[model samples]
Target chain A: MSALFEFCLRMGDNTLVLGHRVSEWCGHAPVLEEDIALANTALDLIGQTQMWLGLAADVEGQGRSADDLAFLRDAWDFRNLLLVEQPNGDFGVTMMRQFLFDAWHLGQLETLIDSADDRVSAIAQKAIKEVTYHFDRSSGLVIGLGDGSDESHARMQTALDLLWPFAGEGFEADATDLELAGAGIAPNPAGLRAAFDARVEQVLQRATLSLPESRFAHRGGRTGARHSEHLGHMLATMQVLQRSYPGATW
Target chain B: MTPIAQVWEWLDAVPDPEIPVISVTDLGIVRDVDWEDGTLIVTVTPTYSGCPATSVIAMDIETALRDHGVDRIAIRQQLAPPWTTDWLKPAARDKLKTYGIAPPQPAGGPESCPHCGSANVERISQFGSTPCKAQWRCRDCLEPFDYFKCI
Candidate 1:
C-alpha cells in the first residue's frame, strides 16, 4: 500500500473502531440525553470512517470498498489507535476516553484542513465541524461529571489515569507519517503533540482531575503491529453479522 | 427542449427528505446548477457530516430533474465551506417555526421556543430524531420541540 493509503487506513480504522465503541452506548447510556449525544457522536465518526476508508480504497486502486475494509479486516490487520479500541469501562471511563481522543482528533483535523491533497482537506473540513461539537460535548461532560459527586470525581480521575498512557500513541509519528507530512498531504502527528497536551491539561484542570504522572507509553496500532486484547473480542461481535450475512444490506 | 432555468425551478420543488416543509433549494443544499455538454450538474453540501438525509436529497434531486424531462444529471457533493444552518432562507425559518421546529438561534445563544415564542427553552438532548436537530423543551408552554442546532 502507498504511504497515503496507509495513512488513510490508520485514520479510518481509528474512527470506525472508536465509533463502534461509542455506538455500544446507544440504548444503554446512563440517561436519555447521554444516549442521544453518544449516538450522534458515533454517527459523525462513522461518517468520517466512510470518507477516510473510501479514500483508502481509491488510493489503493483495489476493488475493496469501505465495508470490506471495515468488516473483513482482522484485529491484527486493523490500524486504529490503540486508545480507541480500549474497553468502555464505565460512563466516566467512556467519557474520559472520548475527551482524550477528541482533543487529539480535533487537532489532527485542524491541521489536515490545509493538506495539499484536496480530498484529504475536503474530508477534514467537513469533519472538523462535527469533531468540534464532539469535543465540546465530551469536555463539558468531563467537567460536569468530574466535579459533581465524590464517586463521579474519583471515577473520573481513575478513568483519566487508565486512559492517559494510550494517548501518547496519537502523537507518535512513524516514517510514513513523516513522509506524508513532508509532502503536505498529511499532518505531522508529532507537531500536534504540544497543542493536544495543552488542551487536555486545561480540560483536566477544569474537571478537577490531575494529569497522570505515568511516563510509560504503549505503542503500535498505527500499523497494527500490536493491539490490546479488547480489540479481538470487539471485532468478533462487530464483524459477526457481516461475516455471516456477506453482502447484507438494510 | 428544457432550459437550465427550468431545471433550477424543478429543483426548487424538491423537498428535503428529512424536512419536507422546505425545498432543497430553500434549505440551501443546492449550491449551484449548471450544464456541461448537455448534462445537468447540481452541487450540494450536506448540513452535517453525518446527516443521513444527504444521499436521499441527491437522489431526490436527480429524480425530480428526470421527472421534469431532463435526461442527464450529475449531483456533486462539496465539502469546502461546509453547510451551516445560517444558509436556511429567512422564509424557510418561518416555515420551520410553523412546522413546530425551532430555527437555529445565533451562535451560543439560547434557542427560543417555537410553540410559545418564548426564550424559556432548555436543550433536553444534543440530538433529536435526526442528526441536524436537538431536542428542546419550553419552560413556558411545556412543549418539547426540535431545534435546528447551530452547525
Candidate 2:
C-alpha cells in the first residue's frame, strides 16, 4: 500500500477498533446514562472510521468498499493503537483508557485541521468538534471517579496505573507517519506529546491521582506486524457474521 | 414563476429525517441555494460530525428539488464553520417544546420541564434517543423528556 493509504488506514483502524471496544459496553455500562453516552461516542468513532477508510480505499486505487476493508482485515493486518485494543476491565479503566486516547486525539486532530490535504483538513475540522466533547466527558468522569469514595478512588488509580504504559505508543511515529509529517499531510506524533501530557497531568491532579513514572512501553500496532492477543478475539466476533454469510445484507 | 425561489420553497417542505416535526430549512442545515451553470446547488452542513442522517438529508434535498421539476442538482457538504444549536430557528424551539423535546438552552442556562414548565427538573442521562439530545425528567409532572443539548 502507498504511504498515504497506510496513514489513512492507521487513522481508520485506530478509531474502528476503539469504537468497537467502546461499543462493547453498550448494554453493560454501570448506569443507563453512561450506557447511552458511551454508545453515542462509539457511534461517532465508527462513523469517523467510515470516512477515513473510505478515503484510504480510494487512495489505494482499490475497488474495496469501506465495509470490505473493515470486515475483511485480519488482526495481524490491523493497525490500531495498543491502548485501544486493551480489555475494558471496569468502568474506571474504560474511562481512563478513553481519557488518555481523547487527550492525544484532541492534539492530533487540532493540528490535522491545517493539513496540506483538503480532505484530511475537512475531516479533521468536523472530527475535532466531536473529539472535544469526548475528551470533556471522559476527563470529567476521570476526575470524579478518582476523587470519589475510597473504593472508587482506588479503582480509578489502579486503572490509571495499568493503562499508563500503553499511552506512550500513541506518540510513536513510524515510517508512514514520518513521511506524511514531512509532506505536511500529517502532524509529527512526537510534537503532540507535551500537550497530551499537560492535559493528562492536569486532569490527574484534579482527580487526586498520580501519573505513573514507569518508562516501559510496547509498540508495533502501527506497522501491523503484530497486535495484542485481544485483537484476534475481538475481530473473531466482529467479523463472524461477515465471514459466515459472505455478501449478505439487511 | 421564479424557479430559484420555488426551489427554496420546495426545500422548506423537506422534513428532517430524524425529527419530522421541523423542516431541514427551519433547522438551518440548508445553508445556501443558488443556480450555477444551469444546475441548482444546495449547500448543507451536518448537525453532528458522525450523524448518520447527513447522506439521507442530502438525498432528501435532491429528491425534494427533483419532485418540483428541477433537473440538474448538486448537493454540497461544507464543514469549515461547524453546525451549532444556535442555528435552530426561534419558531423551531417552540415547536420542539410542543413535541416534548426541550429546545437547547444557552450554556449553563436554566432548564424547565417542557410538559408543565417546571424548573424543578433533573438530568437523567447525558444522552437520549438521538445524539443531539439528553434525557431529563420533571419532578413536578413525573414525565421524561429529551433535552436538545447545547453542542
In terms of DockQ, which candidate is strongest? Answer: 1
Error of 2 at A100 (Å): 1.0
Model 1 chain B worst lDDT window (10 residues):
B105-114
Interface RMSD computed for candidate 1 is what?
A: 1.3
State iRMS for model 2.
Answer: 1.6
Evaluated at residue A122, the lDDT of candidate 1 is: 91
Deviation from native of the Cα of residue A175 in model 1, angstroms:
0.6
TM-score of chain B, per candidate? 0.93, 0.94
RMSD of each: 1.5, 2.4
Off by over 4 Å in 1: none
lDDT of 2 by residue, A1-250 (tens): 7888888888899899999999999999988889999999998899889878988988988699899999998988798889999988999999999999899889999999999998888878878878988998999999999999999999999999999989998898778788899999999898899998899999999999988898577887877777889999999989999999999898
How far residue A212's Cα lies from its native spot in candidate 1, in Å, is 1.0
lDDT of 1 by residue, A169-191 (tens): 98888889989999999887888
